[model samples]
Target: MKLLSRLVIGLVVLIVLAYAAAVGYMYFNQRALQYDPQGPITTLAETTLSGAENVAIPVDGSVVNGWYQAPAPGKPIIVYYKGNSGSFSAEHERYQQFVADGFGFVAFDYRGFPASPGSISQQGILDDAVAVFDWAAQKGFPLVIWGRSIGSGPSTYVASVRDAKALLLETPFLSAVTVAGERYPYLPVALVMQDQFPVNQWILDVAEPVLIAHGTADTVIEVTNGERLYQLVPNKDELWIVPGGNHGDLWARGIWRQAEPFFERAVATP
Candidate 1:
C-alpha cells in the first residue's frame, strides 16, 4: 500500500511538471504562433490597379514596403492595415475597392513580413504604423484608417493617436489575447500571451467616426468579439452585421457598397 501510494504521488508530480513545461514553452514562443511574416507574398504587379506606385516609408531605420495610389485632391486617403498572413502585394485587389471608389489607397507589409525588414513586436508594428501615418499625412490627404482581422488592433490604435476622418474594421476581434483565450478556454492566455493587441482598450477614447463590419457566421474569432469591440468604441460608430456571412465572405456580400455610404458619412462629418 505504501509503494502504491508513492507511485501515485510520483505520477501526479510528473504530470504537474509536464503541464508547467508546456505552459512555459507557449509563453516564450507565443509571438511565433501569433505573427506570420513569412507566409506568402502578394505583389502589386499582379493586380489591375493602374498607377499603383511602390512606396517606402522609413521607420525605426527600416523601410516598410507598400503600394500607394493618390486620390484626387480633397479626397480621403484610405490607409489599410492587413491581416497577419500576407504581404502588401497580396492585397492589391482589395485595395482596388478604395481605388474604384476614388479614394487614395496605401497598404504596407508589417516589419518582418516579406517586403519589410525588422523583428515583429506589438510595439514595433505600432511604431511602423505611426511612421506610415506621418508619411501619409504629409501628402495632404484626409486620412481614413481601415483594418481587417488582426489589422484592426493597429487600426484602432492609430485612430486613437492620430486624427482620422474615419476608422473601419472588418471581422475584428476584441483583443488578440481575448480571441486566443476564447479559442483555448482551458489555457491561461492572460498569463502566457506575449502581445495583446487590445483594440477594445484603445478604442475607448477614440472619438472619430468608426465603422465595424462583421460576419455573423464567423467561427474563427467569432462575431461576439466584433460585437464587444463595436460596443467599446466611444465615438460616432456604426455596426453592420452580415447575416450568414462567414469570416472571409463578408466582402462578397456587398461590404464595399455598405462601406461607400459609411465613408461618405464619415468624411462628411465634422
Candidate 2:
C-alpha cells in the first residue's frame, strides 16, 4: 500500500510538471504562432502595376513600407490588410482589381515582413494600420477596410475604433483563443493565447456595413467561425458563404458578385 501511494504521488507530480511546461511554452511561443513575417520581397514599383507608388509609414521607430494608388477625388479607398504569408506583391491582381474599379488601394507589409522593419506584435500591427488609415483618411476619401485571414484581426480592430464606409473580413476567426481552443481541445488556449483579436467583441461596436466571406471547405480557420461572426452582425444580407470554397479560394467562387454591390453601396457618389 505504501509503494502504491508513492507511485500515485509521483504520477500526480509528473502531470503537474507537464502542465506547467505546456503553459510556459504557450506563453513564450504564442507570438510566433500569431505572426508569420516572411522576409522581404519585391518592391511595389517592381510589380509594375500602373500608378502604383511606394509609401513609407513610420511606426515604433521603424519604417514600414506600403503601396498606394490614389484614385480620382471622391472615389472609395480600400485599405487592404493581407494574410500571414507572402509579400505585398502576391496580391497584385487584387490591387489591380481595386484600381481598375476606379477605387484607390493601399496595402502594406506588417512590421517583420519584407521591406518593413521592427518585430511584429499585436499592438505593433494595429499601430501600423492606424498610421496607414490616418494617412489615407487625410486624403479625404471614404475608407473601406479589407482584411483577410490573420489580417482580419487588425482589420476588425481598426474598424471598431475608427469609422469606415464598410469593413470586409475573409476567412476570419472569432478570436485567436477560439481557434487555438478548437485546434487543441486539451490545452487551455483561453488563458494562454496572446493575440486574441476578439472579432466578436469588436464587430458589436462597428457601425458601418460589414461583409464576411468564408469558404465552406476552409479547414484552416473553419467555416463556423465566419458563421458566428456573420450572425453577430445586425444585417444578415452582408454575409457571403462560398459553397465548396476553401480558405484561400473563396474570392474565385463568386465573391465579386457581392463585393461589387458592397462597394457600390459603401462608396458615396460624387
Clashing pairs in 2: 40-114
* RMSD to the hidden true structure, all candidates: 1.4, 1.9
Residue range 1-270, candidate 1, lDDT tens digits: 999999999999999999888788778888888876775665666677877888899988789988899986657888889887867677666688788878888889889888888889998889888888889999888888889898898888999999988899989999999989987787788887878998889988788888898988998779998898887878756899988988778878988887777777877877
Off by over 4 Å in 1: none
The TM-score values for the models, in the order shown, are 0.95, 0.92
Residues 106-180 of candidate 2: C-alpha lDDT, one tens digit per residue: 899888777687777778888988888888898887888899998888898898889788888889999877888
Error (Å) of candidate 1 at residue 257 is 1.1
Error of 1 at 78 (Å): 0.3
Clashes of each: 3, 1
Candidate 2: RMSD to truth: 1.9
